[model samples]
Target chain A: MPSQAFAPPAFADVLAAAARIAPHAHATPVLRMRSLDALAGCALHFKAEHLQRGGAFKFRGACNAVWSLDPEQAAPGVVTHSSGNHGAALALAAATRGIACHVVVPENAVAAKLAAITAYGATLHRCEANLAAREAACAAVGQRTGATLVHPYADARVIAGQGTAALELLNAGIGLDALVVPVGGGGLGAGTAIAIAGVSPSTRLFLAEPAGAADTAASLARGARVTDIVPETVCDGLRATLGAPNFDILRAAGAEAITVDDAGTLAAMRLLWQRGKQLVEPSSATALAAVLQQRERFAGLRVGIVISGGNVDPHALYEAGALHGARA
Target chain B: MPSQAFAPPAFADVLAAAARIAPHAHATPVLRMRSLDALAGCALHFKAEHLQRGGAFKFRGACNAVWSLDPEQAAPGVVTHSSGNHGAALALAAATRGIACHVVVPENAVAAKLAAITAYGATLHRCEANLAAREAACAAVGQRTGATLVHPYADARVIAGQGTAALELLNAGIGLDALVVPVGGGGLGAGTAIAIAGVSPSTRLFLAEPAGAADTAASLARGARVTDIVPETVCDGLRATLGAPNFDILRAAGAEAITVDDAGTLAAMRLLWQRGKQLVEPSSATALAAVLQQRERFAGLRVGIVISGGNVDPHALYEAGALHGARA
Candidate 1:
């Protein structure tokens, strides 16, 4: 793939992606928790992508990318470099189309996540736990298998596909005052920006970023992509550096960053599980944490928060006592 | 309340209850998990009552009872004796109607459950951890406050309310071959039996009971209600002895019992959280466990499993490492 081919997805592309992936991806519900509303001082409409296929919004993008390929292109199958949800999402999407899929996983990837990818019938290619090694491994597998590479966040089709979740939310007629999405590789955030821009122009876009992995915030502030941060956060899903195309789209959309510490994210995660009765991962909690932390900004407003994923390791959560406490 | 007044609810009452509680209760989604279906060798239609108001199917019954009261009857509010979901559900239901709610809780009740009852603005009265003590305490509260006693699973109105969940599931046009529900005091089980009988008479009713609290199974076997078991299980919600009306209704409906041990319930709970991405409690898992345990009976059938609740103590689940295992 050439750099020139990496143009940002337009709102029309998101519309097209929505149509393309409708047959595959789930239109997850928009849930309202009155208790959560009282705690946050806002009417929170949670777009439950955690309940989507593959248990994440990543499935939308992965499905779109796989289905968008020409018949000949798809015959050789699709490949991607992901240590998390995208790997499983791509595998599941490919399985639905009866196509082969390959995933280049880092050595340090979570075992449970890797198991999920394998369960979805994707061939795994192990690589060193770094960007270069992951990319090199993915490239080698793609070259050998004649598989099309689906960049998790940077690809235009993926961005458009990710926007479908927001498009569904916007179509729900909730009239959200603002939309908050957790920023990882920025696929969801950038795509949400495009959706809000097209469907609900007045609705503001807010990116929830972990303070430990605040590269997205830094990139937006500097008006350029930042790729130098060594991520350290409980939110495993939001550990990636923002992709260049994703950065450009988010910055262009004037999306604001709301950074939350690990403590806040964990607290919010507990609230979602305990009060909201939605066992979402820490990354999903960042969006709610941002709303709770900045009460003045969201108070009394109809705020839309995207629950990005629900792929936490149950054993790890139990062993670490991650949600343990009297308050929990 | 007189023992003579505890008439078994008919299909007509369930129909009335559905209309009465429609505004207050959630018509929870019927979720389908392909992986779970594959694992159980059956097509499973999961009635997600865990996503119901107050995070359990108890809300349907509680709300119906609260709203079924006339102005004169509702003047002093409502009271109940419960160690878990019923307490919180009644409290939440009373709150919706702007009425005072009182819960007589056993001393041995989970702290998290007590906290939830309190959070819903219900006054909690602690008593000895015995059925006699609980009944006495509840009676005292009702007398002192002039409140109507809303027996958790015995009252006709409550039973009718519980039937609404099964009604919704049956109305989903899935044509279930069998319907499974957890049987504690058997409010949900009896209600579901009524619903199945009314709408889908062809659908067999199966009660999923905890082996540690298998009073329902014993009662059905011996053709009489049993009340002499000291329950010991992680499923805190399924410890109550079966009510006479609940037993009679279930027996008349020809409902069968499927007993699952604590280990099987825990494993199923893990699967619901991991693969289904629904963080349900041990009690809810019993239904799925029963289906898995008796695969020969359910194989190639459309099985409907009601996920009873999602109000597990997050802290207890973490600190006890309840969901800990390599497979989790």
Candidate 2:
């Protein structure tokens, strides 16, 4: 809560972030599915951020944060503690800026994701597989190398950059009545909320969380941050604790939260793959799953769902798909 | 070939096809990949026809052919003998026209594809698994119900309509040095050749074929059609013998034919899935595989590759991906 001492990202910052990242980021396509619309009883506009650089939307925020640094601050490098899309995105963003990047990854991080981060030319600093150890390692790297530490979601610049995705969607002239985004560390959710407020005030914002990791939903219901719970879902990208600043913006905007079980999320993931012709991770599928679970609330409304990322491990996807298929 | 006696589809017909199918068919996006470019040493522009309605470029031709029928002819509806993307495309196109569609699918056809065709409201008639039986069943359906038979690829209207994809690509102002398309039944390849000749005549045309189904390469080499060999590749959609009219057009265009082995096609399919974040079938992967396998020829050139379709069975994809991963 002490993070409240720092200002949250404003709507103007979102505009600036959009302009800042415009030359580097992809203007991802918006796809429509008639079958999905018929099934959900609503028109669905999918923002394909899975097609973003580094195979995720994380690049937008990383690019913004890296570019926002002053010459002196950027001279040494940038550092982050992530073993997932954020790490890879930050590495790529640093590469674009022609600066050094050091990622403090946990010892047991997914090898595929780690390979992607290293492939983007980031130096890897391994730490124990826990939050405290990872943070200590990241701090040590920053202290030793004079690298600026960019918190994955809690940072204002990162949130503002992530908001540009929704900014582009709302500006595309589609009259979406609602926008659904997956809530993890709440960067994308908070960013989307701010963008919707600035561009299309009438567009309702909804945050989708995995039922197994419903910290965001619990936090919203309790009117307080929930950080002590352990996440246990197939959506590996969405297991982070909610960021205080992100929660502040989301709560202030009166964004609603919905929880979907892993089964429902997997089904939605399969639909997106089978009918939608897009490869997105399970975390990205949660937004659509939440919408489908609450069909009556969204019936006849035009909705935009952000596909967060597509850096899925093929083996994991295969196993999950097989289990889901057998159960079906 | 006697089919050469019939007038081939002209450049004007491609224009007409573009206009005719504009209201119904999606003008799929053109996707570029920097990583793919770096790996292949070529600037690759992918025509994402895999994202087309019914999940393939077959929809364009099917829509045009179905719409080309006059009121009297359309009254009885259109029929096709296919158990692949073409059947599904034709069924959906007929649905748009509010006409009955009869698909003569083989007995051992892929169940998923058959389900797609029937789900689009087509009447399915099953026959023995062979070309003769499929054609006989199609003929019987035509005689029984007075239905118009629409060939999958050989028809002039179909080829013209298929050419619209290349037309749109060339018209997009990107000066492509060459165009590469998979030569399954030669529908897309011939259409692309005709479009290139009409719009960007200097852009060379290349036809990619799976080594297991390298009939096109043999045909081009021997200056005669090679129709006796059986296709044994993972590219199920390309198993059909090349149609006479399609072969004639491709041959006359002086299009170069290249062959890639199944291993290369599978690897390329995985690359498209893992790196490109697009779900493309093996047949579609052949184009990129050919480019990669023949990198010496396409180095530093800007090439347009058609991702022909994306309607893949998840089980098959999983198995292929697992095998490829194990091999890697």
Candidate 3:
């Protein structure tokens, strides 16, 4: 891995990215449900990143990275390894700049996301299921296409770009007590922690991870890297092993970590679908599960949760929970 | 039916409501999209009412109506007939004031919506599936419980309240060339027309209806009321025959009505789910369907489409369109 330094991003970085992509990116809204807030025993504010361009917070970083590429490098274009949102985001960002994009997507990736990447004018290189295969395929594509690799979470610029969402939320001038985020590759969590630390120091930063893929929690506990664990979470986006640079930034953030079971995540997803009426991916639901499972801890606090994405196969929701009891 | 005289509301009513509800309601954001613009052949600016309280635009009117009631009347609480969003909205509004609320919901209402009404400390009185049964049940409930009736759309307070959304959107200063709203009971569309006419006269207003239930369309063409059309649309929220007062307001404001087929609605719903990554209800999708269908008329114009609600049943989405493809 060609790693960038793991220093936390500053408020200036986020403000600059927001300015750079002001015309391209959406300033997504924050949603609130007062009755649901009473149930959670907290004032719950949802930052609706699921409605952002390319359907996830990944677009902010993707746009910044693709737009920042040198003219000659832009000619050859950008490359990334992602099974879903990041691939589509980079494709859209590159397409906006009239540049080529190569994506290494797994063979078992959701078909809708693959179609989206293609629709955004990106060439896809399908790979096997394993991490080694994904890395190998990515290397081959980057070498053959002479495309600059935009590591989803490990790059400094990408992390800086990801902080822009938190900036926009804070800039909305709503005073929130806590900021909750899904722990995926750790870019979002680390960026959010850094962003809130600068703009709103009082807001506590918490990371929600699927219990099946609690790599970030384990890594934080071990005080060193632990990359041997295999993830089996339904939250596909959070399956990545914590990146080295992201781990370093997260540690500096003093971020709190919460683990939610797949069942809990599904319950949270159902709550949002039925009550909040937003179709969100399982990854986004993880953050909600954290607040729901530990309601006492969050009681009376004003909390903000990032609704990370909504790129699920609606068929999968039927398959997993079609006739599930509403109150369950 | 008891009806009020046709009269346009003052712009001051909108400004007053905005100030009155500022601390209570969300200053809902105005979201812009170039991709949707390209698809609709118009510069599309979506006012995201789907993120509002009760997951629909009905909350603005319901809140305003409930709050504006005489203190003694509000204490006895409010009653309404709705199988969907308006019921939930009134329940929430009444609960916030710690008042008694009675809602007459149809027998075939969404199971989740019934739960929402009860969750908000409101009493639900279920009636038969027909419209006559709903109104009769609502009247009986009001008489028996000694509650004030909060009519869904025809009430003057509700119309003035619904206009608050358009007022907020224009306050964001998007300067759209036209505004399109999904027409059901016509509170939102009619209110929007009056607000736009007074505050931004250059912006034209439109009501988009489902072709399967095009009462508003026929009524506008015939220059009178159209009643008893067989409503076969999947957009359950748009099933109501227009209230005489709503027709009077929209007709006086000169707002035209457009209708799109069920297939067109499904296509629009799919585009919102897949491309926009949103989970809006079929009622909200009608306006988007209308805009997507007529590219020539709105080409290159800044068009505002109100995403009315996000209360869809996940199963409904799968049933309406699992394998379906959206037509560009």
TM-score of chain A of each: 0.97, 0.97, 0.94
Which regions of candidate 1 are displaced past 4 Å? A1-4, A326-328, B1-4, B326-328
Write down the TM-score of model 1's second chain.
0.97
RMSD of 3: 3.2
Model 1 in CAPRI terms: which quality? medium
Say which prediction, candidate 1 or candidate 3, comes out ahead on DockQ: 1
Q: Candidate 2, overall lDDT? A: 0.89
Give the CAPRI rating of model 3. acceptable
Q: After superposition, how far is residue B134 of candidate 2 from its true place, in Å?
A: 2.1
Which candidate ranks first by lDDT, i.e. highest? 1
Q: Which model scores highest in TM-score?
A: 2
Q: State the lDDT of candidate 1 residue by residue for B1-328, as single tens digits.
A: 3222777789999999999988888888888887799999999999999889899999999999999898987889899998688989999999999999999988887786788899889999999987789899988888888889999999899999999999999999999999999999999999999999999999999999999999999998999988888899889889888988899999999999999999899889888887787778889999999999999999999999999999876556655767566244
Error of 3 at A47 (Å): 2.6
Q: What does fnat come to for each candidate?
A: 0.47, 0.41, 0.31
Task: Write out the backbone clash pairs for model 2.
Answer: none
lDDT of each: 0.90, 0.89, 0.82
Candidate 3 regions exceeding 4 Å error are A1-19, A107-110, A326-328, B1-23, B72-75, B105-112, B126-146, B316-328
* Chain B, per-candidate TM-score: 0.97, 0.96, 0.94
Candidate 2 segments whose C-alpha is farther than 4 A from its true place = A1-5, A320-323, A326-328, B1-5, B320-323, B326-328
Interface DockQ per candidate? 0.50, 0.47, 0.36
Q: Return the TM-score for candidate 2, rounded to 2 decimals.
A: 0.96
lDDT per residue, candidate 3, B236-311, as tens digits?
A: 8998888888898888888999999988887787777666766777888888889888888998888888899887
